[model samples]
Target chain A: MTCKEAFQEISKYLDGELSEELKRALHEHVGRCAHCKVVFDTTVKTIELYCDGKLFPMPENIRNRLHDLLRRKFHERAV
Target chain B: MHYTSMMALEVNRLEKGTDRLTGKSMSAQPQKATERAESELIAEAKAGNGDAFEELVNRYERRIYRLALRLVGNTQDAEDVLQETFLKAFEHLPDFREDSRFYTWIVRIAVNEGLMKLRKRKSDRSEPIEDAVDDQGQVMPREFRDWKPNPEQLLSQEEMERVLLDAAHKLPASLRTVFMLRDVEELSTGETAEALGLTPGAVKARLFRARFQLREELSKVFKSEKSLDL
Candidate 1:
C-alpha cells in the first residue's frame, strides 16, 4: 500500500477496526517500508499516551472549590 | 399427638418454601432499591430540593470538572464554565425531558458554554486562521514543517507530556473539541458528532486531521529533543 493509503487507514488500525485483509496488507507494507513503520509507531504511541490518562490531573484545590461552590449554591437555593 | 405432629410438619414445609422465595426476592432487591433511590433523588432535585442537587453535584464533580478543563484548556476558564454549566442545569432542571443520561445532558451544556466562551475570545482577538486563505477562500497550501535536528535528543516522559499538551493547545478550537471528546474522553464518533451537531463523516474527517496535526507537532518536539541530547 502507498503512504497515502497507509496514513488514511492508520486510525482505523489503531482503533482495531480494520478488516483482516486490510490489516494484513498494511502489516506487510509496514514491515517493508521504513517510513510507514515510523508513522504507524508514532500514531500508536500517541494514542496510547492519550488513553493511558497520564496527561492531566485535576487539582485538589479545584475539586474542593467546586464542592464548596455546589454546597453554597444548594444552600442559597434552599433559602 | 399424631394430628399435632402432622400439622407441625405441614407448617415447616410452608416455612421452607417461603424462605426460598424470600431469598430470591432479597437477591433482586438491591438493584431495584438503587434504581428507586436514583429516581427519587432525581425527582427531589427536580422539585427544587437543594440537598439532592448538591448530592448529584458531589457525585459527578470530578468528571465534570475534568471535562470542562479539557474543553476550555485552562483551570480558571474550566472553573468558570463549570459554575455556569451547573447553574444553568439547575435552572433548567424542570425542563429536562429525562430521556438522556443526566451526565450526558450536563456535558452537552458544559460543552456549549465552554465553546461560547472560546468563540467570544476568538472574536475579540481577531486572530487570523493559521495558513491564511487565498482569494477563493480556500486555505493556502504550505510546506510540511518538521522539527529541527540535533536539539535536545531525549526528554523525560513528563517533558514529552508537556510538549504534547502544548501542541494540543495549538489546535483550533473546533478541532481541539473533537480531539478531546473523541480521543481524550473516548467518546464514540457518533456521540461526538451528535454532541457537536456534525455528521459522523464530518467528525471522522476532523478527527483524522486533528490526529495528523497532533502527530506532526509531537514528532517534531520529540525529534528536536532527541537532537538536543546528542
Candidate 2:
C-alpha cells in the first residue's frame, strides 16, 4: 500500500473494519516502510490511549450533585 | 450478578440482531439479556421511576461528562452540559422511541448542549481553534511527519496520556465528538453517524481527519527530530 493509502486505511485498520486481504496489505506496507511504520505504531498507541474511557472520570462531587438535582427535578415533576 | 454478564443473560441488543448490515444474530443469547435489562430500565423510567432513570444515568455519566469536558474545554462548562443533558433526557423520557439505544439518544442531546455552550462560551475564547480555519480547506491539517515514540525519549504513561488528551482537545468539536463516540465509546460507525445526524460516509470522513490530526500532533511530542525518508 502507498503512503496515502496507508494513511487513509489507518482508521479502518484501527476500527477492525478492514478486510483480511486489505489488513495483510497494510501490515506488509507498514513493515517494509520505516516512515509508515512509525505512523502506524504511533497511531496504534494513540487509539489505545484515547480509547481509555476512564481517563476522565466524573468526580464524586459532580455525581452527587447530578443525583440530587435529578431527585429534586423529578420530585417536582411528579407533584 | 456482574453488570454486563448479567445484562447479557436477560437482554440481547435487538437492534444488533436485526441490524440490516450485519443481520447476524437477532436472537443471540447474550445480547438478548443486555437489551432486556435496558429495556426494562427505560420502561420503568417512563412509568415514573426516578431510580430507574438514575440507574441509566449511572451507566453513562462518566462518558457523557468526558465528552462534555473535551467539547467545551473546561470542567465548569462540562458540568453544565452534563446537567442539561440528563435533565432534558429525563423530561423527554416518555417520548423516547425504544428503537434506538438510550445511550445513542442521550448522546445526541449532549452534543447539542455542548455545541450550544461552545458558541456562547467562545465569546471569550481568545483565538479559538475555529479561527484558524479562515478557509474551509485550510481547516484541515495535513503536514504529517514520520515520528514514532522513541524509547529514549518515551515519556511516562501519565505524561503521554496528558499529551494525548491535549491533542484530542485541539480537535474541532465536530471531529472530537465523532472520534470520542466511535473510538473511545466503541459505538458502531452507523451508531455514531446516527447520533451525530450524519451519513456513515460523513462520519468516516471526519474520523479520518480527526485521526490524522491526532497522529500528526502526537508525532511532534514523541517523534525524534531526526527525520527519515520513506
Candidate 3:
C-alpha cells in the first residue's frame, strides 16, 4: 500500500470497516511507514481521550435540577 | 440498534460486569436476571411507575448529559438538553413501542434535543441555520508526530478537557456531531445515520473526515519532543 492509500484506509481500519486482506495491507504499510504509524496511533488515542468520560462531568447542581424537575412533573401528573 | 440483539449483548457484557460507555457495572444481578429487570423497569415506567422511570433515568443520565454537552458545547445548554430530553422521554414513554433498548431510545431523544438547542442558539445569534451535511471530502493528515503515550495523564482533567473540547469544536458541527456519536458515544454507524437522518455512507465519509481533523488538531498539543526524522 502506498502512503496515500494507507492514509485513506486508516480511519476505516480503526472503525473496523476494512476487510481482513485490506487491513493486513494497511497494517503492513503502517508498520513500515513511520508517518502513517504516528497518524494511526494518535487517531486511536484521540478517540480514547474522548471516550474516557473524564472530560465532562455532570455538575451536582445540574443533576439536582434534573431530578427536581422530574419530581415536580411527576407530582403534577399524579395529582 | 435492535433491542433483542442488544439484550443478548447486554447479557454477555453483564457477565463481564462493565458498561462499555461508562466502564462501570450497571447491575450486579445475573445477566438474564438483570435483563428482565431492565425490561420490567421499562414496562412498569410505561405503566405509570414514577420510581421505575427514575431508575431508568439514573441508569443513563451521565451518558446523555455528556452527549448533550458535546453536541451544544456548553453546560447551561447541556443542562437544558438533559432536562428536556428526560421530560420528553417521560411524557412519551407510553408511546415508546419497546423496539429498542431504553438507552437507545433516550439517546435518540437527547440527540434531537441537543441539535434543536444548537439551532435555537444559532438563530438567537442571527447566524444561518446549518444542519448536518451528508458527506465531507477526505482530509489528508498534515501532522505526523507521535503523541506522548498516555497523554491524558500529562494534563490535569480540566486541561485535558479544554484540549479535547477545543479540538472537537473546531470541526464544523456537521463532522463534530458524527464524531461525538460514533467515536465518543460508541454508537454504530447505522445508529448514527438514523439519529442524524443521514446515510451510512455519509456517516462513514464524515467520520473519516472528523477523525482526520481531530487527529490533526490534537497532534499540535500531544506531539512528542522528538522529530519523526522522516
Question: For this target, which candidate reaches the highest DockQ against the unseen true structure?
Answer: 3
RMSD of 1: 16.7
Worst 10 residues of 1 chain A by lDDT: A46-55
DockQ, 0 to 1 scale, candidate 2? 0.39
Tens digit of per-residue lDDT, candidate 2, span B105-183: 8988998998888778668764243424321232233444655444323666556556766787777777777877776
Q: How do the residues B42-123 of candidate 1 rate in per-residue lDDT, one tens digit apiece?
A: 7999988877877777666666676777666677898888888888888899988877667667777888988887777777
lDDT of 1 by residue, A1-79 (tens): 8867877787666555678788777777766665665566555445444544334566788767766876787778778
Residue-by-residue lDDT tens digits, candidate 3, B1-230: 44324323433442343444466754323355444487788899888889999988887888899888887778889999999999999999998887766676888899888878877787576432343453655478898878887787899998887788788877777788888877776677887887788899988998898888888999999999988987
lDDT: which is higher, 1 or 2?
A: 2
- For every model shown, what is its TM-score relative to the native structure? 0.72, 0.78, 0.86
lDDT value for model 3: 0.78
Off by more than 4 A, model 1? B1-41, B124-161, B224-230
How would you class the docking of model 3?
medium
Worst 10-residue lDDT window for candidate 3 chain B reads B3-12
B144 Cα displacement, candidate 2 (Å):
7.0
What is each predicted model's overall lDDT from 0 to 1?
0.63, 0.70, 0.78
Q: Give the number of the best model, judged by TM-score.
A: 3
